[model samples]
Target chain A: MKAVLGTMGDEVKVFGFWASPFSRRVELALRFKGVPYEYIEEDILGNKSPLLLHYNPVHKKIPVFLHNGKPIAESLVILEYIDDTWKSNPILPHDPYDRAMARFWANFIDDKCFPAFMKAVMGPENEREKAVEEAGDCLKTLESALNGKRFFGGDAIGMVDIAANFIGFWVRIIQEIAGVELLSADKLPALFKWTDEFVSCSVVKESLPPQDKISAAFKARIDQAQTNTRP
Target chain B: MKAVLGTMGDEVKVFGFWASPFSRRVELALRFKGVPYEYIEEDILGNKSPLLLHYNPVHKKIPVFLHNGKPIAESLVILEYIDDTWKSNPILPHDPYDRAMARFWANFIDDKCFPAFMKAVMGPENEREKAVEEAGDCLKTLESALNGKRFFGGDAIGMVDIAANFIGFWVRIIQEIAGVELLSADKLPALFKWTDEFVSCSVVKESLPPQDKISAAFKARIDQAQTNTRP
Candidate 1:
């Protein structure tokens, strides 16, 4: 309920789309940091928020974290800001190598894995199998990366774990929306278990929007897209 | 030249491909840090380096910065490691927000710009235009992000600058090889200037491989791919 102001003491605000996974990542980071933030939901596909545009002139995309007056675009960047500014429970590890490891995996998820998932979601129907295969390869790599750690950072949740949380929650919903299972329990058991533990965390559990609502919103969007023939 | 060993202070070695942009990024970072590292050039596409495989069991790619014994993978991650361990001239800004900003742009370049460039490089003749357009969009965003800053970290070159240095040098060569003009002086004047300045920096200038060698290697790679597809 707290207003999220910019770091320079400009009024902090988050311009986010309700069902966006990227937006959710920022929200979770804020909640974990226990930082006060004002959330302004934008109808990204329909109406653009002036605040979003003003804050993120380049990408003009949500979720844009406006601290004081300076706007930090990019979910991963915003998350790091929250960790740095708040410094309550550090989201990134203290040791540089450990921190680098966390960042490496986080980057892996953002750069490699997310694209595979997106392809599975948006590729042509005939290419679904190929997309699924790509998604599987990405997931397999992720599974190996976990290394029997409770979270990607081991035991406690860290930046990499938070970044990869999309795999746990959104990936399932996306598979459902796209009608393909990418992370079956049989195939990615560690990742599946990690997802359960990740969402079960009090901070994450509290921050998550209702699943039914998200599912409904996604389905509606997909239907609209199918009807419109535009991406 | 000092040996660039892993974190544990084992025999320091780097398994790299002579012409790989990613490998060169690490090599430059190491040289900047004055880390003595043995450079073992690998035939990456045909024959894998045993050290590369042994060091980076997960990715099996370079530039793997092997400190005494521990192997660190990912060029960006290795750059950070080199910066952290050596602490010569810091590659990243001290301010976390600035660091995050640098990281965001770097990630943007790696995830968006590089992929677009690759598409332009490998696409069929008919798809070249679309690929170029995609690459242009990415370059424009990068230009806007620069906003008259000398380097991504304002005055000094940092991790983000190193990550994006490829745009200045390799991109032009790739453009030459692919016969596509994505980064013209008119379209991305700031970036063009930045690239010139970046490559001219004493450390970067000295570390860079010869342009003729790079161009030949890249052309050969493309030719090999084309030949492999011919029936």
Candidate 2:
């Protein structure tokens, strides 16, 4: 496998939590681009690493990519940076409209869908019903957006596909943890098929943390939430 | 006023809601780029215009930019399209890292900042405090993100700047309508200065909706919310 080099130097570092979908998105992007980077795992809920804080002082969030000494925060931003700095495999299309479409869906995932998904994952039983309804709306929109394309960008995994991958992979895991199914295959055949194809991609398959590990981590998180809420 | 023209013989049309910050962002981008497009206002809350539904079938949301009859949904996507399809004024940087940085802040505005701002605007009286606190945190991070740059894109009023312009303008109006001040100059000096500079820009100043109109609209919205809750 060819390693992608950073613009500043040979050393690249990523600060991320183990089970975060955002962190996974960046990891997949790096692996797809063949970028060689050292991963530093952080305890997101308990304590953040000093390096993580220093690197991303503004947001202080995980998935901070450090190329040489300069730090870039936000998974979507880092994906674009990785694609731009290393040109081995382009993650976005060359055409501006195509790029915009990719970004639009990516933003949609971050802005609208993720929130609804989170609500379903972490909410009271009564609120969970509403959350599921919202998630269903989001999934329907995503299903329609896929519209016969093998991938969101068609024939290739691009930025939007990377951004929306969480809905495919993590949503099921989250459902397993939450004990409810959010995405039904019958309702979203294309998205489900795309999910299968997406994980089968050599880069994605290799980079993904084990599903059992993810499920365990998610279960622990829910347990913690429940414990905290107990009177 | 010079009308901003798209490609030769292409009819440019914008499907937008009157008071949406997302729609306003697109309008600002078009006006700044000097692109001429026919504006079709959609009654999004009651009856979504047929053009809006036709143009954006996937999400079916407003601020859909139709250039030569091809529809592009999402404000940031439309902004990118306007910047790319027209070359009169560039909204993003030529350098990829800089462009990524601009996008980072733009995504910051869309994902983090705007949601908090909206929550503060529409949330209940008790929830407003927490929402305001979150909005303040976002603004503080944004202040640090600026880091002495004249605009979010260094010297240029780029895409990120356009994306964040609502925080400078509508936020203040909403704060007034809600009887709360979320952004104080003392708390976020740099952000406040940037807000002033942003609103004072020639195109921005010219294109902004009248303050009285916005205030009245907000008042009506508040009344509607109250009426919906009445027994």
Candidate 3:
């Protein structure tokens, strides 16, 4: 899809937040490709560094990857770039049609799954039930995409699976903190299995943060949501 | 990015809506690559054909590009697939970083511009102003992407330019039909200029619909929206 030759001299820097699935997506690609990169954690919630702003002036968002000081914004864009530059451990399928399918589903996950799943857990009380139903429908569709493959990329973590990191890892913690469960073995067995398979992957394991850290961050989020919702 | 060898025997079928930017994107890429294909105009706003349903079972949407019976859905996905399969008239840049930027801006057009711009034109009266502000902001950012280039692709119509077909052509008609002025020479000179440059290209001119036809279609849409908005 997109990479460069990974070496000590390669000027690879990742501007990311500790908890953003977007930033972790960049790290996952680099690690999967065995690319060494200097990681800079951003104060995403408070103040982004001037450098981060400079790199991604338009979006000014995290998961901005820099190669030789040139910035690549958007995590999926960065993923493809890494895949192309490194040439090894290809994230996208070689076949063009399959690659298109991968990109489509990856987009569906980001554009559909994230919002619905997040709302199912974190949205207003009045809307949570509807979001849960919507999120379940999305999970059903996603489970079908597995089609008995071990991963969306088939037998390994690929672009679609990486693009779905939020549902795999963060949702597990966030849903627990919010006392909601939209994704489960009973409802979406394939996706449920994928969650474990993805997070347990030796390569993905390194990119994931401690579960407790995620729990604490989301716990604070829940408290803030409750405070904001209070009359 | 992607392509195929085009000839009489190649079974390249495009299931598209005549006025849909998404479907038109697929057509634009094919025309750019000199690929020969059958174009089936779908009744997208009505009952979608069984073939369209069968081709893209997941999204059940238009711009389904079928190559020798293999289906590729999503306009952007199909666009890249066309670029890869054709091999001639490359739609994407060869450089990995440039390719990534192209992908980013393409997604930005579909994900950000379309929704914001559409809402500005078609949403409820109360929401139109906010959407106008939002759509304006979005256009400002897009104008920056031009960055003095004749097109987002530079010198010729490329992925970004083709991807922006909606804003380049449809908006000129839609905004006028909706009695709104979101994009204009005075407001966004670069994007304003890009619209003409993109649509006037011989390759794109073949794909665009007649202005009267677009006017008639959207005139009906505005009437429907008004009826729905009435007490």
Q: Which is the leading candidate under lDDT?
A: 3
Runs of candidate 3 exceeding 4 Å displacement: A1-4, A226-231, B1-8
Question: B80-152 in candidate 2: lDDT tens per residue?
Answer: 7787778777898877667878878887888789888877777665666798889888988888889998888
Q: Go through the candidates in order and give each one's DockQ.
A: 0.55, 0.64, 0.85
Q: How far in Å is the alpha carbon of B30 misplaced in model 1? A: 1.5
Q: Which of the CAPRI classes, incorrect, acceptable, medium or high, describes model 1?
A: medium
Question: Rank by TM-score, descending?
Answer: 3, 2, 1
Worst 10 residues of 2 chain B by lDDT: B1-10
TM-score of 2: 0.88
**What is chain B's TM-score across the candidates, in the order shown?**
0.89, 0.91, 0.95
Q: State in Å the error of residue B145, model 3.
A: 1.4
| lDDT of every predicted structure (CA atoms) | 0.78, 0.81, 0.87
**Per-model TM values vs. the true structure:** 0.86, 0.88, 0.95
Q: Output the lDDT of residue A189, model 1.
A: 97
All candidates: CA RMSD (Å)? 4.2, 3.7, 2.3
* Top-scoring candidate (TM-score): 3
True contacts kept of 1: 0.69
Poorest stretch of ten by lDDT in candidate 1 chain B: B1-10
Residue pairs clashing, model 2: A4-A34, B4-B34, B4-B35, B4-B36, B5-B36
